[model samples]
Target: MKDLYHPAEPSLFTGRESANRAYLHENIRTVDLRSESTPPTGKVPALFGYACDEGVRRNLGRPGAAEGPRAFRRGLGKLPWLQEAPDGLADAGDIRLDTDRLESAQQAFSEGIAQLLRSGYFPIGIGGGHDIAFAHYKGVRTYLPTGRKLGIVNFDAHFDLRSPGDAPHSGSPFFQIARTCEQEGFGFHYACIGVRRDANPQVLWDRAKELSVLTVAREELLGSALQASLKKLKTFLKRVDAVYLTIDLDGFSSAYAPGVSAASPMGYSPWEMMPLLDAVLGCGKLVSMDLAELNPAFDTDGQTAALAGSLVHRVLHYPGLF
Candidate 1:
């Protein structure tokens, strides 16, 4: 059976040049417990994916999230080449998820990430929803057992800190991570950038303040220069050992990114937002990244996906201090 979601085509971005897959496959490796085989070996970074579309809505008998991984792969495949490198890169393929088992799905996703980290590979997750953040954090925590403090810089219109309940939805990831870290005696710092003033509740704001989270409101974001915001964010990240970046496409204005699960009228333009990411890349310790909420059904001309793909390229291509 041919896998519809095959590893990325080496020639897609490499053009007529000698493909990197042969070299990468020999050097990069994956331990397949199912087949009882040793992992592959390569220098190219492995792109591990989790296409989760399961959540409360799906659990309630709505559409399943099986399409997320494919949609994101489509976007990624369409990305333009930015820089040249000798290393080969390939998608490690999606982590299979059970829609009916949320906790189990989270555990599976987390373990996949832990495995990738252990192999010294960078993992770029494509979301089924923002709730995947919890799994990403879990992976980071599991891999970094040295007690290194980690910080999160989330770019979203919603705060995503809703109280824990029987069901975990996309709107409750940050809260779940925060609460989990608190219970486990870990230092987790959170900074919410590009937040919509009206989207968050008073209680959420009070909690953020109490936790000393650096909340940058949309109004403040629009008012101040991007350089200023970058400066402020850099200072915050400096206090932490490593950083995980989660960018929710809804943080971009509807005109800029109309494909998001929740589009907002007042948000940053693509040009306005890219610099912030550039600033984050400058920080040098960007451990992992997840770009979420891109609903292609609402997109026109594939612009949103293209924009997202470009950002992913930038994240991978950008030079760093590390």
Candidate 2:
């Protein structure tokens, strides 16, 4: 695992945006270049980034999410924390792909995460692409007890359940997961919020139904307003013992998050999205989580990365019931 990734730089943590204690660069732990330093004392959540975008290229999409980790770090570095504990933050650095070996990279990522969970740290991943979900799921699965079911709550516009071609891509994470769940005899309970009708085609829709996936279409996500969506999500969480929450920044409108690969003009706002996030954190079943698809190239004023970073801050600080 040593050469599989680069260690984080302490320089990335220095910024004078404010005098407040919200600056992540000052507070976060950086993995040393030589080897791992001792794990921070206490039950703190560990954070890491996936800095590869080969999944986007494999899917025939834009390139640049490889820079997501750096952008997210810059955005996150400026925030001020309110009543947060200092020892709770650790940055494990980014997972690097071994020269077109995305599968190996993913497995390394999974093992890294599994290690974090085994050591009593809540693991949160910032992904280069949505494909990280499959790896993230694998890490979560490694820690769960036998016979336990895992549920995923994804905030995205598409199902990401397309069947794989020669290998896995960003579009086929859930499909791969669903198939594996069947083989492993574990129930795949997914509740997706903010699915866009125009973004996904009919076959994907039918496939989603076939898998018995619970979807909250973009319109329905805001049908009775955000509180209703939060309530529905809360109800969905009751069906599983543990959870892995994924946020694809593309789920938000381009106006709010313009840096994503496939920006949507018609999507939820930060105002409309946070309540549901609050509810997800409130559910208390969260075992792992990921924030994906923050393409800084298309971003305006670092809004998308900053938003992802803000959400990352929230999730990391959440004192979960687990």
CA lDDT scores, all candidates in order: 0.67, 0.80
Worst 10 residues of 2 by lDDT: 31-40
Model 2 residue 25 lDDT score: 63
Candidate 2 backbone clash number: 4
Per-residue CA lDDT of model 1 for 1-322, tens digit only, reads 0122234333323222235433222222333422322343543455655566565353232233345555655656543443443244446666555545656667777876677667666677776667778888999888886678888989888788877588887778888898888899987699898888777789888878877888877765654565678778888888888888888877888888877667777887767666666777788777777777666666767666776777766665676421
RMSD of 1: 4.6
Give the per-residue Cα lDDT of candidate 1 at 319: 64
Worst-scoring 10-residue span by lDDT in model 1: 1-10
Error of 1 at 223 (Å): 4.8
Who wins the TM-score comparison?
Answer: 2
Error of 1 at 20 (Å): 10
- Candidate 1, superposed: residue stretches over 4 Å from native: 1-43, 56-66, 84-86, 223-225
Model 2 TM-score is: 0.92
Please report the candidate that would top lDDT against the real structure: 2
